[model samples]
Target chain A: MKMIIQPRDERTQPARIIAGYPQTPLRSPKEPLVKRAPTLSELSGPLEVAKRVKLLGGDIAGQGEKQAIGQLIHLRVRVLDEDGAPVGGAVVEMWQANAAGRYIHPNDDDHAPPDPNFYGAARVVTDESGVFELRTVKPGAYPVPTRDGWWRPPHVHFSVFGRVWLARLVTQMYFPGEPLNAQDRILNAVPDAAARDSLVARYIPPGVEPYNALVFEHQIVLRGRAATPAQP
Target chain B: MMIPTGEATIGPFFPPRYVDAGANDLTVFEGRKAKGEAIEIHGRVMQEDGTALENLIVEIWQADAGGIFRHPADPRHAQADPNFLGWGRAATDAQGNYRFKTIRPGAQEGRAPHINFMVMFSGLMRILKTTMFFEDGKDPVLMAVPAARRSLLIAKGNYEFNIRLRGENETPFFDD
Candidate 1:
């Protein structure tokens, strides 16, 4: 049987396009009506220290005998709540293709050879300081079939499971100064350029101490419009 | 008062590598049966155009039969069922079909029996959040929704729910 759903309540609705870009042409014209739930945010709750501890400090991508055959990078990030308080114990999961633009999964039929050393997945918990770090090689750009073969910019897929479902976020971290960011439709789906820019990670120059890898800092704000816009 | 975070698609190519062996069954823990009525929840992940959205990830979290969430934030004094995981994940098959073996979640303050859903797939810019309620419940949120559309949120007999990404009869998604 069919049901005529009501329009979403404005008070509970997020900002359209900018806050929750539907990704037009890509979004379903028959997409379901949005229902605003006052209890939705309560679905997530504080994770246990035991569960949190199990996820801390695991290499996500660089697991090969060699350094994974790409530019070495040291990525650091801080997780924060809406009130600007550091959120400890949140699980940060990351997965991505290797430096050769190939994932270590059977479904990735791109024919790009997977690096044996690159595990391609990692998990960590935000420490008491709300900071987490990962040592990995830069992922290469990969192509997906869109109109005439769309090439996804170099990016790492991130999934943050915060204390509450309201804080749960899944997004891609793009490299700063990547020319393809301008041409990519997924990145451009976000109407606000400033908000879109929040997805890019910036390079930090290696200090004189001679660290072997390039560093990038990307902070994840769980539920806020401040520095990092919350993912819809 | 905090603005909700935006979402991004989980992308295509999320292989079975991420699937934990027992992720699709919430009624069992370490081979022990959970302490609730076992029910089957089945649905299809379809696009607005009635096409199946294969390979999409569907994850669900809900409170146990005692109305207590497995999460630490549950304020109610209910005890959690040791054998109930209260969470499950499944990927849509070639036909965009997914199913879960779970229990009927109990009601809690300001809410009725329901299951929370998170959908992730390629083409989607971000994950979509929604809830499924039993037709028998009297949830204020469900009641507030228009009568005709309320059926969209209610699971029918046989516990079947079909998720439409867009188009006519689109499922009701939440901004929460």
Candidate 2:
């Protein structure tokens, strides 16, 4: 079945080419994005990605006797489609810096210390209700690796593969009220406050089981599947 | 509540743990070869100045040799080749070269067989969605693209599709 996919709302999204972000000027096309009709290629995607990639489970802090260092936090992420319906079996790949705001990658030459107990990468699949939880140390705000005078706010990078190809999303989830978020070029790339606010996770006070970690809940809305034709 | 979430870069420091070794070879999976004509997709990802964009993730999704999508949405998806891994991901090397070992997809009705490429990397604020047609024919979708730039969507010389992030001859991108 062919799908009538929806076009992105450019206003609520970042400009195709953003300024001040040095990479955009070199990476973005000078011409406007081409609009095309949807095809099965865009409607279909790989299934069981988490199975192929292997799920690292919800614990990114590792199984060491000594847990990762820094503020313990639990992140609850729920993925929804454009119609506000849960996306089940979606693969949510998350990677972030450790408590000191340093990544395990060799390229992360930031002055922060990398925690041996934290590799900082996890693949969690949303349950039938489109919910997944992650437990790790709060990533610290670090200076951009580009060595620009800017400090990026504490954020977790997310790569989600929804049920269909059209629903694919690679985005960042920001913490609320972070000082650097105001100046973070990536976060400010989208001029709309409401759109920017959607990137921030809501704070829920720490109190429940595994009570040591504060909880931050975030919701990600992917492009919805096109309307299916009615059956006779 | 229904608003789409904002986009962000995948960052240069792709977690090594996510780089599954030999994930690019989709021609075979689980000790079995897919039933189709195997092909190689080789390409480089460069910046506006032609600087190699290393560690960039290039993911491809395509139909089977029969143009049957393994996705359940396809009415005949059940007929899809079980050994065929419909999609795969590969990270560019130090020199910005990424390769995919897969089969040539069969053309869907009224369309040409092609591979869908989604690129993600640091500084790319949004996901880059594009397609690579095996050969130019009467693909209607390609018709919508500017004629002068349509060749940018076609892979040149033995499936060598280099992706230039910007500048002259920049690859055309689409919104999903």
Candidate 3:
């Protein structure tokens, strides 16, 4: 018996290589993607990923005394398969810059000061409803290190592991209404306007949520069809 | 119509503590060591320019030494080794090198002993997916790959599987 994966629809993906991103030209292959039918290796994936890594719950904001200095926001993200069904038990691992746009990583020598309170990495498992809520400070926009004057809009990097390896997806979520979203080479790389809009989270004004932080609602749609029944 | 979310760059800022030092080891489960021949897979992730690509995350999923997977998708899930942790993740060091400690997986579904590999980094905008196999075994899927490129999937002497993102030496990556 053999299991198969739904081949990716290229129109929804960004060009493997982006022009402005200096690393893309060198690292991305000019060759076309190889095609093949998936076997058990592709059908199965890691189970209980949360066990290996600590699940810090939803909040990734400030520690005890000092708080991360940014507009505190409650971001609710839903992880769903493209079939419109909830994807329970999926793991969503995420990381972002501090309110000052400085990452705790040593490579980030950007002038933005680091918030001692903010440890900007977290992982959570989606509930049976396919939703995971996050409480954190809004990440700040940062400039690209390149001489070109490109700056990234406030966004969060997401690594999603669905029920199967074929459903795994890694992407960035942009905040709606940010001017940078329009100019982001990566976001614009998707040819479909609707798909690009899907990457941007919707904002809800404060006072609506019980918490003081502004609310942003986002949904991540992983590639559809975990397995298409084994063929004898 | 179903619309899937688009891809984006991993960017340069992976948290230093993405995973603890123990992430590189997959032989332990609930404090008990797994059963079978323990082996190590080491490799450097290289960018197109031939420079080492640092901070890239390498994750692998494989069946236990008994050729069983704990995942429900596998029919043999129930027989999986209770003490064998089948998943491992490690980040590249400053030298663009990453290593994983685990036993050589048993053949699964009549396929060869292999570890499913995925690469995530700041440079490439999407996940780079591949498989690592031992030199002795022949997987039908690896055979499906072009004859010239099949060598890229096999770990050579010393079990080193260096990954090149591009160029003539690039590894044969599959799209799903």
Candidate 4:
């Protein structure tokens, strides 16, 4: 049967600009090519680690001195873009140690101490300028298994949301100048010295009462950079 | 503004960065570098009877190829972006066809979980939401591609991913 081919211009109409769905129109080469939504490169940011929520099940809050009531580790974080603008609609999840410096999960098994009431898990979404906060206790040092041997350090875990499974991240925020930091293998594995240092927060004694509480200010960064291709 | 309708329920929190980040205009790019590959994201949103529906708004989000989210909370574990959201929106066409041209999201934290997606249409009661996974290949090497591309494939040399609405054979909720 004889076939009629459509004109090239007629076949190459750009996709109809749908109002909301930003990623659409998968472009194609052949005829009758209705404009295809574009395929985007992977997105990135400051923190990208994945850990199971259900798996985090130890308790580390509710211990320490009675003065520990307000001994929470206050976190002030700002989320920004390449242009230094705050990003809206992003979500953040943080899990940290309680006042007694322990995790609230049963799996943590850090017998150094126990804080029955502390579960150290909270979730928050960003507002118009991409800022989020978490009221938690300064994580205490805990002995964990490692290749060299067992080591302990004070730290908290954090996760960010891009959307759904994509947004999930699992990472720890360590306290700056903590002696144990020098021995932590994972902490040392980070190649970027400054980036690695950024993960550690400094403590400022809370001004109220006995001044036992510690305050940490941390800034997290998320970026999408591909490793250089391996040489043949 | 189009109000979401359907049975799907969404969580109350957006990342602090998303909440505080300012607005961005999507209409600024003018070159091929800014141009994304267009693909047919055709799928059916059905009733228990498997009947197709229309006018539904399907949303998607993913990180760029380098595996960084446009938003601040990305799992870079270090470098953060104050802007990129990696999120997008689209309404299904007459044949339950919905499409988007978003960057493939990176596999943060190692598990490489699928990105969450949601759909809301007219007639249906509450919003219907669910998560979608990148179609990673059987081999670990191939599986290493970012979650967004793993969810996408070259069908007839065209990048595409067909979405399915909740009912049977699809995920149940959005937040999980």
Best by TM-score: 2
Which of the predicted structures, 1 or 2, would earn the higher DockQ when compared with the native?
Answer: 2
Reference-based lDDT, residue B35, model 4: 26
lDDT of 3 by residue, A188-227 (tens): 8888888888899998876787467789999998776534
Q: Which ten residues in a row have the lowest lDDT in candidate 2 chain A?
A: A223-232
Best candidate according to DockQ: 2
- TM-score of candidate 2 on Cα atoms, chains taken together: 0.95
Determine which window of 10 residues in candidate 1 chain A has minimal summed lDDT: A1-10
lDDT of each: 0.69, 0.84, 0.81, 0.41
lDDT of 4 by residue, B1-176 (tens): 11100111111111222111111111112222222322333355554334565545555555544455554334352352333344554555467665554444455544343444555442222233344555543523224333344333222223344543333333233221
DockQ score, prediction 3: 0.63
Point out the worst 10-residue segment of candidate 2 chain B by lDDT.
B13-22
What class would a CAPRI assessor give candidate 1's docking?
acceptable
lDDT by residue for model 3 over B98-145, one digit each (tens)? 999998899876698888888888868888888888864467778767
Best first by lDDT, ranked: 2, 3, 1, 4
lDDT of 2 by residue, B80-121 (tens): 998886789999899999999999899888789988899988
Shares of reference contacts reproduced by the candidates, in order, are 0.35, 0.76, 0.68, 0.04
DockQ of each: 0.41, 0.70, 0.63, 0.05
User: If the candidates were sorted by their DockQ against the true structure, best first, what order would they fall in?
Assistant: 2, 3, 1, 4
- Badly placed stretches (over 4 Å) of model 3 are A1-4, A226-232, B136-138
Provide the lDDT at A62 for model 3: 59
lDDT of the structure predicted as candidate 1:
0.69
Model 1 DockQ (Cα-based): 0.41
TM-score of decoy 1: 0.84
